[model samples]
Target: MAQNVTRAGKSRTDFRDAIQPFLAPSLREKCATVLAGSVPGLEEIRIRCGRPLMAIGGNGDFFITPQGTISQSPAQAYLPDREDLDRSLQLLGQGSAYALEEQLRSGYITLPGGHRVGLCGKTLVESGRVMRLINISGLNYRLARAIKGLADPITRYIVVGGKPAHTLIVSPPRAGKTTLLRDLVRQFSVGIAELGFPGVKVGLVDERSEVAACYGGVPQMDVGFRTDVLDSCPKAEGILMLIRSMSPQVIATDELGGRKDIEAVEELISAGASLFTTAHGSDPEDLRGRPGLAALMEWKVFERYIFLGRSLGIGTVEKLTDRNLGSLINDKFVLRPRPGSGD
Candidate 1:
């Protein structure tokens, strides 16, 4: 029998160790205090100059008070000042903002543990191009996490006849599409022992630096021992490059919607490399409405379509269908808990 895989414990240790060190001392203390208690399903930490410190979690968005308590009233929350933002920026840049010029121009920095700090500020435009960001105003710290075995239930549908099927994961924003895709990459690269599949060479094009979350060319998240990542590279170019150079058995990338991206997907298909990718949509009609994606659907490019949503909490596999969009299962699939989880 295939043993049921349980959801991993939600711990804030990764966030505390990886992200807190870069926060301003005072702000760090407040965050640490809030995290010292039960985990809040924390997803994002938003800090804006002269604004209350805000955190977004599974439950919803809430403000963080100076005493490290969650507050519904923003008026009572701790307000970060100019100095706090300045000091935090310096720490994030390691005392040198100029050193992160390229990342700043791109408006985000990938931290050590795959955590990304998004920057929004005044821009220095030269010839209609943003040279760099200046007078930083806000920062959104998106915590990166890996839920091992999260893809266990869907792996069987993904792999058929000893090979990965061309699959497209559909989900709205924050609906766990990226998280699910990340786990899928890890499983395919490491191989699913329960399904008698061996690990294969997997190429990952991290266009947004999210899937693999590479920092300084090293993947902080576990994508599997056999995965090769192309960090911060465009999907179209990176896909073709991986096919010619790495000869990956499967090529995974995030968000496919552009004309060039579709063309590249064609190349990947022609080359006989399996594909694992995601798109921002709730259903098949949403995909058919898009010009680029509509063509692929007409051609039946993907063999399996997995729809995800938050109806049963994040990472919920709402539905699974075959190429023809016919239901593959009669009922909503629920993740089984491991023995003694007490759920």
Candidate 2:
């Protein structure tokens, strides 16, 4: 138990170190102080000019006081000023915003450790599209975490005959779909020894830079040796491109929506490559309600469907089903939290 606690502490320290260089002095100190406690489930740190400094954890959202203590009332919280935001942006961009113009145009920047900072403010629009963001007023620092063995229990359902099956993970926001997808990619790419599944080439289309979290064209997370990541590329284009170029046996992507993405999935299937992806929904019915997914469901494109929820815990696997929506598992499976996993 003590060793587990120590491991958790080290994990928190690593998380702090990853973001410290990008924070202003004052904000950094406050964050460090709060992190020194037992906030193991810490997920996001939100900083907004003229608004309360807040930290979101698994329990709920709470404001951080100037003394680095949690507060329920925003009236007693610390408010980040213009200087704080400016200094943070400067540090995040390495003192030059122009160098990160493309990332800013996408409204977020992926940090060195795969942590993401989401930006919000005025937008520069041209030809019916947003060119860039200016006068940034808010920033959401989302911590990146890789839970190494999170996919172990579900590997049997996803891998068949030493190859990946067509699977779609369904979950609401913050239900660990992305984390599960990341681990599945790693396991499939690196081979699961226990299951006697040999590694296969995996093409990861990380559109939001969340799954693989590439930094400077390299994956910051441990995706796997045989995985090839197309960082920050659109899902549709990336899928087809990988089919033509990488010759991957399996293609994994996050959040399947939009007609173009569906069209790309069809192309991937037609090319005989396995597909592993995620979508935002509560259950099979929720997926059927969505137009794009409904079409895919009618075609029986996905062979396995995994549903995740927070009834028991954040990463609980509420149910597993076959292509016809028949129950595959009789009991709910809860993912055990690894020390310092922050899942």
Among these predicted structures, which one has the highest lDDT? 2
Per residue, candidate 2 scores C-alpha lDDT tens digits across 215-272 of 9989988898999999999999999999999999999999988899999999999888
Query: In model 2, what are the clashing residue pairs, if there are any?
Result: none
Number of backbone clashes in candidate 2? 0
What are the TM-scores, per candidate, against the unseen true structure?
0.92, 0.94
Please write out the lDDT profile of model 1 over residues 1-343, one tens digit for every residue.
Answer: 0121113423556567888888998898888855553326778889999899998877888899998888889998999999989999999999887799988898999998788999999999999999999999999998876676667778888887889999999999988788778888998899877789999999999998998889889998788889999999999999999999999999999999899999999999999999999999999999999988899999999999999888887777788999999888776654433243211
Among these predicted structures, which one has the highest TM-score?
2
Q: Lowest lDDT 10-mer window, candidate 1?
A: 1-10
Model 1's TM-score against the true structure: 0.92
Superposition error at 60 for model 2 (Å) = 1.3
Sliding window of 10 residues with minimal summed lDDT for model 2? 1-10
lDDT of each: 0.85, 0.87
Give the residue spans of candidate 2 off by over 4 A.
1-10, 337-343
Q: After superposition, how far is residue 307 of candidate 1 from its true place, in Å?
A: 1.0
